[model samples]
Each structure stands twice: as structure tokens, then as C-alpha cells.
Target: MTFAIGIFDLFTYTISGSIYLAFLGYLVVRLHWVDIGALAGTPVPTLIVFVLLSYLLGYVAYPVGAVVNRVVPRRRERHPRQEFLRRVPTAQDRDYVQADPFLLLSALQLHDKDAAAEVTRLRASGLMLRNCAPPLALGFVAAIVELFLSRTPAMAAGCAVLLAVGFFSLIVQARRLSHWARMKTLELCFWLPDIDERYRVDRNAGGGSSPNNE
Candidate 1:
């Protein structure tokens, strides 16, 4: 269970880690600087070069995505609970959503005391361990495959774009987590426990106990 949870947490970074390698492989093909035959001739040095370029390319894509995020205005959202409830009507649905960090945020919003504390614990664990490091290592590993395993230019470009999308999605999730954390902190200052009333209303409306009751 723990290993599965950790992998779920690292999913985005894991998926995106190969962007650098794919981009590097694509560049290698486009520039005509080195071919498979030459790489075989000088395997070790060529691999080292490819590895560095792959990691560097991943870093390069990060700033480009950041800049684009800065330039674009984020859409305003309100009544998040209503939105969440609309989508997650069953305990089964909530269970699946729990894999997402958004589950933590939703718990805070719903005044789930346990979830709030878990968020703080997660925050203290170090971002590199919890967030960035997995992706960095994955990127390096992907670079190896891109350099040695893949050969087609089109496939390389496709992989690069897919990884870029995953990388950008992780960036978006990080921003949402930050925003939700701030909201949770502010709400803490003026804490209110409305769970009893919420439960009462749910029962009166012929609904069963809320999923959070678990």
C-alpha cells in the first residue's frame, strides 16, 4: 500500500521525466551530429554526453512552461465543494480521487481534521523527496533509453511532447496545491466546525453519512 501510494504521488514526475531525453534524441537526429554507428564506436563518452544533454533539456523545458504559466491568467473558481461533490457522488469515486493531492485539499475544505494534519506532515517531508527528485532520476534513466533504445525521429518528438505535457501538468498541480494550502491556513485562523450541521442536512435530505464519516 505504501509503495503504491508513493508511486501515485510521484506519477506526474515519473511520466514527465523522459521529456529531456526525448528532446535530446530528437535534436541528435535533426542536427545530424552523431549516428548510431558513431555512438557504437565511442559508446561510453557518447552516453555521457547524451545523459547530460537529456537532463539539461528537461530543465530547459521547465522554465519555458513556467514563463507560459506566468503569461496566462488562471481561471477563477468558486464553490469548490459544490464542484467536487458534483463529480464525486459515491465513496468509490472519493476513493479514486484520494490518490490525487486534490483529495487533501478537498478534505481541508470539508473540515476533515485528519486530512488537514496529513497535509502538514506531507509538507514537512521535503519537496525533493516528495516531488522533484523522482522526476529528475527518471529523466536521467529515460535519457539512457532515448539514446540507446530509440531510433526514429518521429517517435522521439512524440515522446518529448508527451513528456512535456506531463511536466507542465505537474507544474499546474504544484500551483494548485500552493493555493489550496494558503486557503487552508487562512481558514485555520478563523476555524469553524460545521460538520454536525452538514451531516444533519445530508441526513434530512435522505442522503447517507458523508464519505468523510469514514
Candidate 2:
């Protein structure tokens, strides 16, 4: 039962990880710079270069997507449990829309190692072991299964390539999210104003005027 829960938990967090890689691959092809090949036909060199570019792009694209997916939700989620104190929802797994961001922000700033304590504190507090790491492992498992179970050489190769792209993207995104969370810690901690300042001068929906907001 625990293992089954673990598997389900892993899948939920990995949403959007695969799709990002395909998008990244398309971006790589669109930006591929090899002009030596014929405009109409891909030459051996161009094909090789394109493949290399695709591989490299997946490395970057996946990470960027991961950063965007994780951080945006973290920063935006509002707390229903506490009007002033909210939790980060990604790793929480209880209620998505009800999550508060500040609760998460405080947690990350405390637990992480690289002063990334801020980011790590935020990266799905309870779900670190439960959520973040498993999908990466599963992606690898799927890749291996495809490589061995495939019957035809071409199909096997295609699966291998697609699987690689997808998995690679997930990892990149994971790493990038951590990085962005760290950076965001710095940004929110030092640069951004308190929520009151951000919404300055306006009366809140709860009918309270913000201090220094005017």
C-alpha cells in the first residue's frame, strides 16, 4: 500500500514534465544553426548537428520548464487555512487551490543547504521524499523498459529517443526549479515589498486598508 501510494504520488508531480521536452525539441529544430547542409535536404553533418542540438536543447528546455511550472504555482497560491499565513501546495498534496504561499516560503528558507534553504524550504515541503525524487527515477525506469522491451529496431530507437527527451526534460526541470526557488528566495526576501506595499493604497477585499500602501 505504501509503495502504491508512492507510485501515485510520483505520477502526480511529474505532470507536464514530458510535454515540455517535445516542445523544447521543436524549439531546437526551429533554431538549429547548421547552414552547411542544403536548404531543402538534411546532410549527414546537418543531421548529426541537429541531433546534437536536440539533445542539448532538451537539457536546457526541460530545466526551464520545470522552473516555470514549480515556481509560478508556489508564488501564486493563496492560503485558505490562514488569511495571513498560507502554505505552498506543490509538495503538500492536500488541496491545490487552498494552499498558501508564505507558509511554504518560510519552510524553504529554513531547510535547504545552499542558502537555497529558502528554495529547498519551499520545494514541496512534505513531498520532497514523496514527490520530487520519484518521478525522475520512474522516468529512468520507463526508458530502460522501452530499450529492452521494444521488438523492432526502429521502434525501439524511436522510443529510446522519445523517452530520453522526456526523462531528460524532467530532470532538467527539477534542477531548474530548485535553482529558481533559491533565486526567488533572494528576490522576495530582499527586493519585493510586503504584500501591503504591493497592493498599496487600495482597500483589501476583506475591507482593511493597507499600511504604507497609499
Candidate 3:
């Protein structure tokens, strides 16, 4: 069942990622990188292949971006730009952020310096992947538009308009993710980890016992 759900999730993301990639295609068309009329002469089957390829590329972007992030040296922000609810976050904020599995186990509970480092690396990688989506989306859109522009101008125009609207929504989602990644990094820095059973029991009844106990 879990495996099936994972498959479903991957398919959903692939299609969604591809749609966003269409935004990239839109930009390319607007920039005249590829003449739309030229695509009109291309065979219908080839155009279909182009559309599929764009989607595949967008889906691939996530892992590629993540890998690139691991290679890149990230600059630490001494302080994140966003204002917190308080100069010192309240217990509620701390609890909320620590609910994240990576922050909780990797940073707080273990307090292993290496774990903290890994968390930071993962966050940086995630940010890069999110940032890559829009540009890739635009690229995909441009290709589709160019391929169909001459043969199906109306269809091409409609796709462009629709994708343009969706692109705005994607931009909002990407920004939100960026903010979350920043706040998570800041939260990791401030939180103190206590893996004691007493503390865990008081905070969360379901919080598991120490691994050594098992």
C-alpha cells in the first residue's frame, strides 16, 4: 500500500511539474528563441514527442537541482530577513517547527553536529529545486508553443494564456517554500534538543523511547 501511494505521488508531481515547466516555454516563445512557424512544419508525431520530453525534463529537474545543491557551497545567512513574531520565538513556534522530522531527529534530539549539518544541506538543496521549477516550466511552455504555433495558433495561444495564469500560482507556491526553508534554518539554530523520556512524555505521549532501550 505504501509503495502504491508513492507511485501515485510521483505521477502527480511529474504532471504538476511539467505544467509549471510550460511557463518556461512561454518565456522562450516571447523571447523568440525558437520561431513558432518553424515548428508548424514539423510532423505531428514529433511535436507530441517534444511535449512529452518537456514534461520528462521538468520531472527530472527536482533530483538534478537537489544534486547540484549538494555540490554548491551555500552561504549562511547570519540572520534571515523576515521578522519573527518575537525577538525570541515562543514555545509554540519552537514546537511547530520541530515537528518536522529532519529538524526533530537530525538536529534537536540527536544534537549531533553532523546531523545539523545534514539538515542545513537538505534545506539548501530543497530551496534550489523549488527555485528551478519556474524557469524549467517556462522552457517547456516555449517549446510547446513554438511547435504548435503555426499549425494550431489558437490552441497554442490558449495554452499560453492558461499556463501564464497557472505560472502566477506556481510563483506564489515557490516563494512560500523559500520562506519556509529560511524559517526552518533559523528555527534549527535556535531550538534545543532534549531526548529525555520525561520531557518527551510530557510533550507528546506518542514520542518514542530512546533507541538504546529497545
Give all candidates' CA lDDT scores.
Answer: 0.45, 0.40, 0.48
Cand. 2 TM to true fold: 0.29
Clashing pairs in 1: none
Candidate 3 has an lDDT of 0.48
lDDT of 3 at 151: 75
By summed lDDT, the worst window of 10 consecutive residues in model 1 runs over 91-100
- Please state the error at residue 61 of candidate 3 in Å: 4.3
Ranking by TM-score: 3, 1, 2
Predicted structure with the largest lDDT when compared to the true one: 3
Q: Write the per-residue lDDT of candidate 3 for residues 1-214, one digit (tens) a residue.
A: 1212233233334444554555656567777897878766899778666556645665566554444334434444222323443455464334433343343434443555654554444444444344454554465466465657567776666666665555444444444554554555445545564433334454587654231100
Q: How accurate is candidate 1 locally (lDDT)?
A: 0.45
Name the best candidate (by TM-score).
Answer: 3
Model 2 C-alpha RMSD to native: 15.1
Higher-TM-score candidate among 1 and 3?
3
> Which regions of candidate 1 fall more than 4 Å away from where they truly are?
1-115, 121-130, 133-149, 192-214
Q: Could you tell me every candidate's TM-score relative to the true structure? A: 0.32, 0.29, 0.36
Indicate the residue-level lDDT of 134 in model 3. 54
Greater TM-score among 1 and 2 belongs to 1
